[model samples]
Target: MTYPITRSYVAIAAPPLRSIPLHFSAACLTGALLTDIAYWRTAEMMWTNFSAWLLTFGLLLGALAAIAVLIDIFSGRLLLRGGLGWLYIIGNIAAFVVSLFNAFIHSRDAWASVVPTGLTLSIVAAVLIVINACLGWAIIRQRTGGLEE
Candidate 1:
């Protein structure tokens, strides 16, 4: 008599719960970018104020996310392996730095605030945030073995 073969599969775990702040930070930064554009088009003070508030919230959330990442790293719940992980870190740092500078620029008068320089920085920060998010999701997928929620 022949016996049937059996196979077993292991389940992949979900990403760390602390990553929520990082996601929120990304959204706020993206929203700031949109508001910066709105201010540029309409020269409206309200949009400028909105961009400033968004950038502030993004910075605060990003700081919390950084702390959470450190905690995860120390607790062995998250791993940063190879160059991709470093790239993600560097990208996030760059995005945050750019946004910080843009926030300072936005503190100026309405018309001068989001013109050439402020708008340029917002664009750069938004682009960097997007790239970091892509890299982060790729890392998560790799860790999860392409598993879906």
Candidate 2:
């Protein structure tokens, strides 16, 4: 005898994922990659090099991530209700601010450019964003009890 297939519709009670953390995580990683390019440009002392292109691309991605987060918030899929949410927001904001400073002001120098400062800021931002992602992942894991929710 063969067993019959069974299907059931189940409602998930766990809170919807807060996608902002993932977006910010991506932004930070992209920013860090751009910073690496910037540092390389500083070493080469060339402004109109591949670094500029990479920076522009990174900026675009960062903007997209921000827009995605905003849309998710408005659509009620993402929430900024808890401590982790706030931390994620703060980290993302700080990363954005520092990235702006590095890109606009400090990146202009020809010789040294903003390598040191921008690299430091990018690393810090990436760390914070990754930590925030980990926190969210931990929560989801705990809620799901080691299974996909």
**What are the lDDT figures for the candidates, one per model?**
0.86, 0.57
Best by the lDDT measure? 1
Cα deviation at 120, candidate 2, in Å, is: 2.1
Residue 129: error of model 2 in Å?
A: 2.9
Over 1-149, each residue of candidate 1 has an lDDT whose tens digit, in order, gives 99999999976665675589988998998999899899888887999999999999999998998888888878866778888878988898898899899889989987788898888998999899888889988887877789644
lDDT of 2 at 19: 55
Candidate 2 local lDDT, residue 141 = 61
Model 2 backbone overlap count: 0
| Pairs that clash in candidate 2 | none
* Clash count of each predicted structure: 0, 0
